[model samples]
Target: MRQTPDCVLDRPSVDDLDQFFSIVSDPRVWTHLPSGRLTDEEEAEAILVRLVFADRGLTAAQLGARLA
Candidate 1:
């Protein structure tokens, strides 16, 4: 997690499944997404699982890493 005075930013994990589903399933969010919004909780969970595992090899700091 990264925190500044204004807010805290966290990486997506299984713990955020509900919030992730709520945002992605919203109609407004769907309109802007080419893949469209999530269809159901199960689908959201699957996606989140993939996301969580996909990030397992990286750290938050490395998200901004570059070659020197």
Candidate 2:
């Protein structure tokens, strides 16, 4: 039988900050953001904090990314 994992997924831990930076650091994803590319690591960290903090009611927001 096929099963699904229905539990809510927790936010990625701080140890994964580099992965977070890769997302926010890209200018394309920041098209709606004022700062284009992330200011730096600290700024990227802040964005992560906010994303997990804000209750924008998205099961998942579709931000763009490219995997190489």
Candidate 3:
């Protein structure tokens, strides 16, 4: 994690579950997404585990390849 006078930047983890859920479940977030907002904390946790945390093992090159 990196912190500066402006803000702190860090990867999402179990520790961020609550905040993550709050953000993901907000209707404002759905405005730009074709997908629906997360329904609850449980759903958020599942998404984080399946999508976010699962990507942590990849290297930059692997991530780039996946993106490509």
Instruction: Write candidate 3's Cα lDDT for 1-68 as tens digits.
Output: 99999999887777788888888988898998837888878888867755563667765566557657
Q: How do the candidates rank by lDDT, highest first? A: 1, 3, 2
> Which lDDT tens digits does candidate 1 get at residues 1-68?
99999999999888998899999888887776747887789999877876776577754455335212
Q: RMSD for each model, in Å, please?
A: 8.4, 12.2, 6.7
TM-scores for all predictions: 0.71, 0.44, 0.64
Error of 1 at 32 (Å): 2.8
Local accuracy by lDDT, each model: 0.77, 0.63, 0.76
* Candidate 1 vs candidate 2, TM-score winner: 1
Among residues 3 or more apart in sequence or in different chains, the pairs in candidate 3 whose N, CA or C atoms overlap within 3 Å are none
What does the lDDT read for residue 56 in candidate 1? 79
Colliding residue pairs in candidate 1: none
Clashes of each: 0, 0, 0
lDDT (Cα, tens digit) per residue for candidate 2, span 1-68: 34458666555655668988988788778888856777599987756755653544333332221111
